[model samples]
Target: MAQKSIRYNYFLNIFRIGFGILAGLFTMPYINRVIGVEGLGKVEYVNSIIAYFVLFSALGIPMYGIRETANRRDNLKEKSKLVIELLSILFVTSLVSYLIIFFVIINIHSLLDLKPLIVIMSSTIFFSNIGIEWFYQGIEDQRYITIRFIIVRIISLILLFLLVKEPKDYLNYGIIVVLSSVGGNIFNILYLKKHLSFKGFTIKDLNFKRHLKPILTIFVASISVSIYVQLDVLMLGSLKGSTSVGYYVMANKLIRFTIIFIVTLGSVLLPRLSYLISNDKEQYVVYVKKSLNYFLIIAFPFTVIFLTLAEDFTLLLGGQEFLPSIITMKILSPIIIIVSIAYFIGYLILYPQGKENIYTIAVIISAIISVIANFFLIPILGHIGAAIIAVSSELVGVLIMILLYYKELSKLELISVNILYYIIASFIMFLTIFFISYFNIDPLVNIVISSILGFLSFFLFLFIMKEEIFLSIVLDLKSRLNQN
Candidate 1:
């Protein structure tokens, strides 16, 4: 299969990411009013529970599959066999996960009420195996993946609005959520023929054992990472009930929404980076450096914007019911930079370099600290505690990775002096937005205006300072226009 240019894939991913988030953002205010905090919290808590099942069923295969598939992209026969082998393993794992969840829901008296919601959401685990999105990522075929995601998400959004009309309709919301995920997978399964052929791969040709060790290593890392990420919601729900989960997840989802942009920027590099590690180490380092610089430029501004306008964002996006999330959002905003760095270090660098062990260790240690902290903190401090722990744990994980890879990191010079320009520009933008927020304007109008002016000032400053990355991008665009 022929691969598209990195720029092409990146834009497609960005369009899909932007569209999906915008759709959710468009619907959230209505949903928040209709469902209310407690109702949303109930759905979030149930979804978080089902997320664990999905994570286990996945078994790190998604991450592993991306690298393995990219490695074999030039060899269709090998790629087919590898994909089949991974899918076979995924099938058993998802089936087992479903059975286990079924037992938990049926046998636990407290969960009896949520059984229907849980059952609906749990189908996501099974369909996840069929989706094989990792396969698409590995081949760097963002066009198909992006289109399928946007279509399914759009359909789900329409269904959400149509079906979920009241607080009592949270179950309907849950069903739509499942359909969103499962629907995408249905397309994915059908679209496999574009790149992969199942022929000539007998059962005997499949080699699960060859892939087992690396898959398991990444699986362990994935589990640790999920525990670190998801445990907060679980603990918050358990200790403070669904209302608190709603507040926390509201804040979290906003941060994650911004993070999708940052993640997408670097994620397109993974298959290429995986390929480059063996074929061209020098080029790999160059991409990593450029990506890190771009991450900081994007992340710092996002962090500052959220930190400055948390109230406006919270009020606008989630409405008055989500006021508590304002502070939570502020606490979690810095993770934009932290996670961008961690993603660059872990997925782009460590996994591609065959250092899943190091990646695993960092997150495992962080997860341990998170679990311990969450236990002590959630009961007393509630969602605020969870937010604090989330930031700290991610920071710790990033520090560990940097510490472990200091020698190599020093060579790459991941931190650029240009980041200073980004910081100054962000501070200026922050002031611009902060000043705007003081005016007695409508929340929605104020935010729209503040965001425009803030980002405008940010770029104006970057242009004045002649930031290298910004200038480079400008010159590249100019060149492209001239060519056209």
Candidate 2:
């Protein structure tokens, strides 16, 4: 029954992520028109810088706390204790982050133009700490968090469409985004109290120092991960400038949201996987292989879309000025597969089992390679260079995970023939999309047609293959719903 509830919540969270993406999809074209390339680029550049401080404030607590809390969910007192302890650490690190941000703004010569937005965006660090989403996630209570996402995002979406009307309102757009994050996190506090109360809990309950070792280990791993996530944008902003950042971020605005739907499956499964690691190893292995197969099902087709409709997508979403993003999207599309598998290895398989060092090593080496590649590439190729390095770095990370976890993979039965099925399915979809593109119609109509045909092809292929993992999920979900 417990596992069934988690699965149902996972489905709900999937819808939440999908709807949130759709809302952003609705908002993006309008915002891109109002902000234009340079204005949007400037907003992204500052947010990229602020992303560092956000990581600092978060300090790996989200993952660490989730694992720790999930492991101790039976002990309400202990779960509450962990939340308080983690939040206390988040407060200190957030303060440090703010101090550092202030120092950076004062001393940095290049960031003067972005200073005000930098300060404005950095507010996420503080508000996000109060949000303590880690607290909600740790206890495996996704209901309210998903609800919070819908309410706040819809509100932000309304505010965005209503207020952001011109290029001059770029800062206003930034404010809306930042405040939405802050407000959402603030709302997290209310939902958190309902799940894990701290009525008798006091400072004495928190072993802040005890958490630092594990939390900081995860924090370092997170910093390494941030290399691919945030550093690429910062490097582009620094070496290539805001217009380049704008084009790259425009791809990110679409691609990252697409990634979210698949990735949240991993997020929803992590705590459950953690629970399985200690109590149900067989279940753990079964879940791992199935989830990964599901990812390949989704990732393959999305990569094809990016490659086939790159031009149409760029023209429609970002307007003609961002045609450069067409190439960037194509360069970066392979990451769809690379990141999904890598995330499975790093987060679902390793972190839940307390294999932080291996995970950290993989991310760190990838981060180092990313830094080297960006330094060498960003100056010459700009966003194109950044995109190439991002994809390559992710590929390298996935390879390292595969190599390092080969024995584990064999034990988990990770090698499945279903991979070939997924490829065949995706290839069929790609061929359909490729054929649809030859019509030479309007880009908008082309995207709509290609997407519909491509999705239908993928679905048909999955059905034809009788894909076991995909079908089991569908059947189980239906069975569970019917029982309810």
Candidate 3:
């Protein structure tokens, strides 16, 4: 049953990623046409502000709920009660936070032109706090959540095509996002209702105090994560301007989109890692090592590709008007590699051991460095400086978490020959792309040919290095195709 669940989660993730990529592809041109650069920057800034408040509103309830419900999965009554309790807490907190944010927006109406749009989009925060979908995640029922998102995203795409006709119709774009959020959550809530009975759920019997410590720890960690991740856009918008914010956000979106494969893999591995850590230490260590190895194999080549083709990708994705973000994208590309490694170290290793404080502290330190870097850098280097600070802080944070994880594990097998082979293979792939680009080929053709060669070299290197994960996946696919 667990194996089947894992397999289902894997396929669901593939579908989700495919859908996300398609959505991005569809939305990018429309957004670029409708909002233009400055307008897109304004929209991103407003959304970022609301996202920070949403993080506060969430207060780590989803993480707490997922952990507790997964731990108590066999106990239906207890799991349901825990879900109810967490939902109630999230509800109250979201309401209060929304009120405060709305009040502030109303009071500061003159300074911000998009207060109405922010207010409309803020409903996503309240709706998402209901926590029905997370219950599915805890029990490994990802198909439902996956289907819900897919349907909503399809609807969002249609709405974008229909409503987003002009550049100044930013308010309509805001509406599209809100509608998608509400529609998706509604579907998730309805879908989840079939699996668990919420009939007897009540807030009166819940005890928040029992889970206060871990909840607070996760809350602080969430805020810290948000600081380095989301706060940069807000800071860029404030310090530089919306035009710069648009460029930075566009670059970030492209880099982050490329890492979705890693992110999906990590999501699948996290629950498995949590289970292994609870049940089998030796297996947990093996799982962590394998996961990290797979990440390195996938992430390293993509990092090199992004660094090489940053300018072409930016021009293709966001147009020539977004040339300013090319440097930003280059600076931020390596972050995917580093952050993927850190996520494995932190979540799979340190987090399950109750060493979440270390993760929180690392993020806090990174956030501090980011703020200082941005303060000095954004004024001089503009968006590119902000991007540099963003990636630098991420690299530093990952280093800190890795050291902490190693200390907790009491050994370091991270520098093994396997990792060395992965690094060498990545370097070879980089050189392959570099040689392909050295010829005075057309830029677009160079990118296509280089990407093909890079991946071909990566697979050849993996074969030579005998990477088990790569080999296994290849053999499995080959066998399945033969059967078909």
Q: Pick the candidate with the highest TM-score.
A: 1
Colliding residue pairs in candidate 3: 34-167
Give the candidate order by descending TM-score: 1, 2, 3
What digit string (tens of lDDT, one per residue) describes model 3 on residues 35-98? 8888888778888888887888788766666666667777766777777677777878888988
Candidate 1 regions exceeding 4 Å error are: 482-484
In each prediction, how many residue pairs overlap at the backbone (N, C-alpha, C within less than 3 A)?
Answer: 0, 0, 1
Candidate 2, residues 1-484, lDDT tens digits: the string is 1334666777788888888778877778888888998999889888887888888789889889778888888877888888777877777888889899989889988888788888788888888888877656766667777788888888898889788999989988999989766678877776666667777777766777888788889989999989888898988878888899988988876788767778887888888888899999988887888778877888888998888998988888889889889889988888888889888889889998888878888889999999998999999999899899988888888888778877877778777778988888888998999888778999889988999989889877777788787787778879989999
lDDT of 1 by residue, 84-168 (tens): 8889898999889988997898788978888888888887887888989889899998888887888788888889889999999
The TM-score values for the models, in the order shown, are 0.97, 0.96, 0.94
TM-score of 2: 0.96
Range of the 10 consecutive residues with the lowest summed lDDT in candidate 1: 177-186
Off by over 4 Å in 3: 1-3, 109-111, 178-183, 198-204, 410-412, 439-445
Query: In model 1, what is the error at residue 434, expressed in angstroms?
Result: 1.5
Say which prediction, candidate 1 or candidate 2, comes out ahead on TM-score: 1
